[model samples]
Target: MVCAAMLILDVLSPLLLLSILLPSYGCRAADIPEDATSEFSVRLYHQLQAAGEQDNIIFSPLSVAMALGMVELGARGASLEEIRQVVGFSHLLPGVEFSLLQNLTAALSDDDSHYVIRFANSLFLQEGVTFNPEFLHLVRKYFQADVETVDFSESAAVAEQINNWVENHTESKIRELLSAEDFTSATRLTLVNAVYFRGSWKNQFRPENTRTFSFSRDDGSEVQTLMMYQQGDFYYGEFSDGSQEAGGVYQVLEMPYEGEDMSMMIVLPRQEVPLASLEPIIKAPLLEEWANNVKRQKVEVYLPRFKVEQKIDLKSILQDLGIKHVFTSNADLSAMTDGKDLYIEKAVQKSYLEVTEEGAEGAVGSGMIALTRTLVLYPQVMADHPFFFVIRNRRTGSILFMGRVMTPEVIEPNDHDFDSM
Candidate 1:
């Protein structure tokens, strides 16, 4: 339901992976509110941005929302209220969000002919624990989650099985997401959610146009990376936050995938300005503004072929976001089972994204002067430096992935390139 957020063409790669695990909690139903989801996505990005500092960040806001939704199904008292408040779902009628979530995900998974977007949700419970049938039914009704019984005492085997399920759903792009150390005898239930997406660019870059180029990092370090160049018509705009917090000017470029249903929006700061200066101004309204304002025009684009992956500890992040009660001993998750002792032990999410040419021939742009001079006929988006990006559904306005590229793909130094010494 959340529409847009900050930066890169992450899902443009061959694969984009996200796997979520919550030990001892589960979710329930939903029709997701778009604006609410967008706000939540922006908030999540801000947290990840602050925590990551100058590092590259990539994660699926929708995946996390769904994971929490699963937990909410079994949550009661403060646990349910906290999730509702943090996610901005309090305004909606109770149980309506389940239908919303189901409809939104169903819409996304509808057209797989052009791109591949898959969602796999499952609940793994300890062999002896008896879960409430009605709660399980609601989870399946809204999230379509598969329910399985496993021996959590065999931590290693359980970890491998869960990781294998994640890998299988994500095209093996993300493997070994959970290790033996992630599970223990106290783990009675684990809710898993995996999202995998692969989409090709509408205007595919020619492989020949991709050449080694210098990528400047935020810390003034530079790395060699394969930069894909193209001169095509894309949604473009220049925006200013109207304050000193962010540099006066920034560029927003929206590149659609094979189907117009989805797009990748890249937000690039001025070459001299650090991306950190611009990130603070990124909010839900700003994202909507970017979505509405960009005009379709020819632009020169130079984006590096890169991959960004990260594993986030959701427990700490959620606690920071004022959702701590669910993970504590005093939590109320009786909706799932009769045992009042059930409390979430750990919540983790690992995401991976890669950007590539999608095996299409690229068109060389006209103009050596454009590359040489400071001024060019069309607006140019040269991502030779760090930038923020988001991959979203153009039609539904759901952000599939949001992240920033601080360092592009790096190639190590080779002896042959240096003087024969």
Candidate 2:
């Protein structure tokens, strides 16, 4: 599978811009399971909602973009059922497909949710075969899957070219989301790509003007981390329930991308506590509470500027993480095809992120200006251990993709998704 494309974790509104942009394009839902449609929509909505609640130093408008790409990938005649299955688990991984699917599904009536996704495949070209009228009709309704065939002298060359295109597409958010091993490791034809993005807070930070701050870990050891400080109109709010004897406010940091309508929103607990410890306190309701409650204040904010990178083979972890049924052979995805024997060969997820304040330069005088951009050399939440990741859409309810990385080593050797132990 290709790495995620740029994803934007936008926290605008249910009537977010994307939602308003694409309204209902009716695609009939085939009769089958009860509540499949509703379940899909709820899952998609909650997934993106969850992404908006996470603490992010890495911003990828990948969820929707990647989903769009994959919706396009479906034109290659990748399994229709498998596409649906991949989209379903995408929320767990929060990959780009998950984000785009969220947008595609929003148009379906609550009862016809499954029907909307049924036509999502129409957006791309299937190598040589044209979809039958039933499936083609749905595709014609929601998405126009038009793809052109590219001819290369060698398959390896073609693959590498595709990889290069991906690297460039992501603004190098991924230089080598895939590598040479990616070419050699797959039993089936493999596809690898990435979505890279770097955007500074419209208001930047000065690195030489950095201050050493204490950052606590889950184990209670307070390590000194540079706190990048800036003051702006934040989604500020506070909460009172936690095991730590300290009550903290949720200080939100919004960093937008240079050329996209996407931004990364990080939620820092206003406490000298480890970010890991406050997991239970981080949830959708909490964000809703914070966004709705925090009184705007010109408060002094201290945050550690650190970078983290992680790689993982998410296939196994996903099944273990509450997404077992879809990957199995029995997965029912007739909604994509009128019940084809298509099966998911593999569902793998890999991700990398970095956060830092190195070489950061900007201003913070409690004011607003446009050209305040700081390029931090070292960046993102370090992925040494385990952390949650997702590809989300700015709008809609469809998890196009999802996965988790418990270990980076799995991807380090550049093993493809099918090579997992």
Candidate 3:
């Protein structure tokens, strides 16, 4: 059962892209409790913050959890327990996380009229390898994962086939997901999970109101970008750590998508304060508090259309999180196969996200607010500087994408319209 493994998880949304891959050698269900997964999401974010520094961050926390759940299906002993502890599933009965993952993903993908969400899970095994029947059955039952047999010796062809499958499921948004170097004759199994979502805003931004504006980066530099402006009723709040720490006062704004089941929550610091000063105060409880306290009110918003992409080495991050058994030679994956030689070789995640002016087709904005520096008529969320954001399911509290925007879509100086500003 010893083999090199690659697991890939992909996410696509209005703010889009992330992919991850891990494998092990078993079998294993409940509704996943809301906020049960928050611990893992927040920990992953902190790890990313430490690793990425000031780079723009983006990855689907739910997507990564699902991929791990698939791996947990075949994991046993310490390998399985490590995942449970880190993923916050230790409280559940031995196998309930699988059902929880299925339910959470199902809830998000069920109502497509308001948004487009698709989940694709698959398993690719080397031909002629005998895997436990129970393992395959449970994976199909809980994840509805399609199982295939591939010849890993032909690394290039295997990479091409897997990449094509990823592209097809993601509406062609993510391509070249795997390379020939990622696979070899020693590879045994590769797990793949892909999630795609596209939704329009409930109050869509009018494209005509977009103008070139100056964006300040944390590094003390400025860039010109397309800033979308609007005045509408939205979930807004102002909060602080009750101390001078975290830069005095900060703002939280929740902008819902078409159905309101999913929304992008932006946390902005004061213009004079840097985002780094505010990052340390972020925790799981703070996320819930911000969500609960926001009030619906009219707001003036100037949000830049931005794109962020990053490739993370999950092997290092997971190791840092205390999930080291599966990646070591002492891995216990006997539940997935009858051999003691099975273990995970490598794991990686790459994510991409783009925020644009497009939202729901027929939805109309309330009105446009005039750009002014001194007037404070309404609680305005001016995202002219670096800020953190999360796109999650409102009901399930499942984080679909989490990251920060330091540099927005930068345009050349000639691209700016001084007259419009």
List TM-score per model, in order: 0.87, 0.51, 0.90
Indicate the residue-level lDDT of 209 in model 2: 41
- Candidate 1 lDDT over 1-421, as tens digits, reads 1111100001111001134321110011123346358888888889999897789987778877887788789889988999998987898988777887888777666653466566677788778878899999998998788888888778799878877876676555556666666666766777767665555788877666666667888898888777777889999999988876788889999988876667889999999889999999998788889999999999988888777767776667878888887777777878988877777655666666667776222223211222232567899999999999987766556777788999876755562221111
When sorted by lDDT, best at the front, the candidate numbers are: 3, 1, 2
Q: Candidate 3 has what TM-score?
A: 0.90
Best TM-score among the predictions, by candidate number:
3
Identify the runs in model 3 with alpha carbons over 4 angstroms from their true place.
1-33, 111-113, 359-370, 416-420
Lowest summed lDDT window (length 10), candidate 3: 21-30
Candidate 3 structure quality by residue, lDDT tens digits, 204-262: 77877776778999889888777888889999999989987789999999998876777
Best by lDDT: 3
- The whole-model lDDT of each prediction reads 0.71, 0.33, 0.74
**Candidate 3: lDDT of 216?**
92
| Residue ranges of candidate 1 with Cα displaced over 4 Å | 1-35, 111-113, 359-375, 415-421
> How do the candidates rank by TM-score, highest first?
3, 1, 2
